[model samples]
Target chain A: MSLKNTEAVVLSQLRLGEADRIITFLSPQLGKFKGVVKGGRSLRCKMLASTMPLTQVAVWFVEKRTSGLHLISQCDIINPFRTLKENLHKLVSGLYLTELVEVATWEVEPDEGLFELLLWGLGSLAAGERLQAVLRIFEIRLAVLLGYEPQLSFCLGCEKELAGRESYYFSFAKGGVICAKCRAGARGCKISLGSVNFLRQALRFQQEKLGRLTLTAASSKELQQILPAYLSYHLERKINSLRFLNLLNVRC
Target chain B: MLYTESLAKLVAELKRMPGIGNKSAERLALYILGLPKDEAGKLAQAILQLKERIFYCSRCGNITEVDPCTICQSPARDAGILCVVEWPNDLLAIEKTRGFRGHYHVLMGAISPKTNIGPEALRIKELQARVSSQQVREIILATSPTLEGEATAMYLYEVLKPLGRITHGGRIGVCR
Candidate 1:
């Protein structure tokens, strides 16, 4: 077993044995991994605070390659993002973001870009950015980072440039838009050109400039339907946290 | 050497328990096999009795053999002060301290977005019902200190704020 130290964000934790816990985390160097923390459930354990989900932590662990479960020796919280956890809506959004990362990633395969994007998402929520804007940006950027970037530039059916299309059919199965002429037999949903333009800009914006891009009501509604379906199509699984977020929105 | 069918079945069944590994399951099976016949019979009967008689108290969601539970039915306990916890074991832990004389409400679980469980999936509605119908004066948010637990506590505070005064972590007399 080799010793490794990396900055990771806690994804989720499960109770192990009587007082131990199995913590899953996402790291820049290690895509996703699970580590066993001894006595994590104890009220006075130092690991208690560091192991909480969505907390950015610096962890030193022994990688047990044979068993596939690392042993976390020491972990220190880098940033607790306390504000995100203090608000219910923000907390749910944070959990949903982490859960998506955890589900989309594979173990031990490093993806620094995705890791940075996750930190940005969590930081934005903690800083009190608009919730809808944060969710849409995170989803679009996540799709791009994972190589499932939506084909927003052209119509898939006739290979025509989609610069001035009034409306288009976004095919979840094809992962792009189909023009009106191509819509006869296409299995897709109609989306407005305004939503398309906003998404295209979102995809090209730098991380720092992403916040400056705001979503119109129509675009927000369109994206709220499109990106998730696109990601779910590519990832081949229903993201459970999205359902939880929907419930919270309904309550509001 | 392979164990007989009966021994293997016992080992398999024991392994299904939490924290029980193959070694522990085998050891426990052997210990049970070596017990006196009458003792073994009594143990089996006790397990059957537990599953048959034990159930959650309708009022507070705590496990009990009775409907309202002894704590709920007791006149000595304060109905106005309610201690809300994440699970029944938490209720027992606080009860063991014998410091608080208030009744309890077990939420059964916390709000965990990863698991897709929201406030509606918890005991929050029943809690609201209890608070509106009763003369509750103070609610002690004794949920755990974990992320999910804290979120659940915050959600509860928002929902129960207009109903009465809500204090966190059971720290009474420390005004918020």
Candidate 2:
């Protein structure tokens, strides 16, 4: 078998026997790969650092003749996300991002655009600026990428353009906005236009420019209500990591 | 035009794994066919050995070849301190840190009303017995930091505190 070299982010790892590990990674070129790293549990193995959750690395592996478990030969760290690890809130958010990517993306299906989006989100989180906003943007963009892009331009069902005065409902089942008229038969949470516009801008902005978008407490609270429902509707399950963030908020 | 009996059986076996579907299972079965004979044999042997040899430790509920497990038998470990975790896997996590020199009590799961898992469903009775009989000073609740985890910790604190001096462990302690 030939050795393939690529850049990847460690999504998760599981112990496989005495000293080896079965690692799940998201590679830019190769999509998701479940590979076996020999002696990964050993202290002398440099791959240990690269195998950490959310660490980006360049990996060299051999596609073995018989099993889907590629044998990792070497790994060089690209970004360790050291700052995210040090800070509790950021670490939880980073883990949430990783969990989302691992769940949403399919194995051996390359989506370069989504990979770039995830990398940018991780980098933004590591940089330690406007984390809440960064996370909101990431969630919106991810939804868009997955083909469930919210219809912010108008009422999702009514085909009428949204105006600043009216409050709209964000529906997970319907996959977008519902105007007051459209809300009669729809099931969702009511959100102000200000918050809707903020979400709209977040979806449109480049990942790096996400920090510039200001979120007031009102908008943030509205987002908290709307986004979770949006995610549960699309992903069909509540994210576990979100609870930790809510707990942290309560503590603070 | 159709798969043989052995190939179909292999696909069915592969599909049993979490998150693997029929298509992926078929892909995996095909991939296994491509491996060198010895390497594939080793993989198959490992699975068989795991199923045959690995059993839950009677005392702590951690996965081990022995009944009481190596940790329970280790003279180096402190019998007075017991770290409570949600799963056998969590026991491995605590052991990996080398920071805790105490014995462990794996609950097998946390109490989740949504999942219909209750205190009686877990190893709580056994844990209480261990605390009383083994002279455990502290019972660290190292469950996941979820709403259910917090509820479980509180329940354990209420139940164990009246019996003895069980410290009220917080989310920060167990998760970090």
Candidate 3:
């Protein structure tokens, strides 16, 4: 067994027994791993709040070789993103971010960039940034970070530059754009050129400069139409949080 | 090591239980095998009766042998004050304290978007109906301090705010 200490964001947690929980985390160094926390479910346990989903913490855990489930020894809360928990929309969005991270990545494959993207996304939401822009930026950037970057520059069908198209069909299977001429009977979501340009900018922006780029309401609507469906298609599973997020969006 | 088919089947069934591993399941199976015939029969009968008889209290969502549950039907408990909890166990925990005399509403689960659970999945609608129909004066959000718990509480607070005065019991556990 090896004791490892790393900073992580809680992705999700499940109850283990009477007073224990299995916490899934995404760490900059450790990637994704599940660790059992003794007394984690106890109401009075000091680690109760620290071990919650979406909270960031520095955790020390023992990596058990036999079971492949680590035993978490200590966790110190970094930023609980307490604000996100207060608002349902923000909370759902934050959970969606974590769920994306949880489902998109594999275990123990550390990617510092992906970890930073998650932290940045959560921080932006908690800081009360524009919800739609934050979400759209996060979705595009995350897709790029995970190497599923959408083909925004050119038409997949005719290999033509897609700079001045009125609109294009985003092909989920091809992970790129299909021009109007090439989209005959092809299954894809219709996206406006403005939305396409915004996504390209989102992909090209520096991580630190992401906040400076705000999405227009029109582009926001268009990207929202395609990004999640694209990601879900590539990920090959229904994103559990999307339905809840959609419900909230419709209500508001 | 190989066990007889019957013993192996029993062990496998027992191992399916939460917190029960191979060793504990085997030990429990052997212990059950060693029990007196009538004692073993009684144990099996009890399990059967539990499944057959016990059900959720329709009014408060607590597990009970009756429809409305004793607490909901109790004359001593104050119906005007409702304590909202994430699960039935939280209600039991509060009952063990015996300090509060209010009725309880068990949500059955909390809102965790990661798990695809939302406010709609919970008993928030029933809670609203109860508040609207009854003369409820105060709602104590006795959810846990965890993210899902807090989220559930906040969502309930938003839904139940215009109806009555809401008391936020941010921490509902044994701790202060």
Native-interface RMSD of candidate 3: 1.9
Worst 10 residues of 2 chain A by lDDT: A243-252
lDDT of 2 at A180: 81
- Greater TM-score among 2 and 3 belongs to 3
The DockQ value obtained for model 2 is 0.05
Show the colliding residue pairs in model 2. A65-B34, A66-B34, A66-B35
Evaluate all candidate structures by whole-model CA lDDT and list the values in order.
0.87, 0.79, 0.86
Deviating ranges (above 4 Å) for candidate 2: B1-176
lDDT of candidate 3 over A1-252, digit per residue (tens): 878899999999898877889999999998999999998887777777788888999999998988868999999999989888778889989989988889999999999999999999999999965898889989988888878988888899998987663568899888889898888888998888888878888888887887888788888878887898888988888899898888878877
Q: Per-candidate interface C-alpha RMSD? A: 1.6, 9.6, 1.9
Q: What's the lDDT for residue B139 in model 3?
A: 77
Q: Better model by DockQ, 1 or 2?
A: 1
TM-score of chain B of each: 0.92, 0.86, 0.92
- Taking the tens digit of each residue's C-alpha lDDT, what string does model 2 give over B64-164? 99878999999999887789989988888878898999999999887653334557789999988887788776667787654356556755765576665
lDDT of 1 by residue, A1-252 (tens): 889999999999998888899999999998899999989889988899999999999999999989879999999999999889888889889988988898899888889998899999999999965888888899988998888887888898889888663578899888888898887887887888888888888888999988888888878878888888888888998888888788777777
TM-score of candidate 3 versus the correct structure, residues matched by position:
0.89
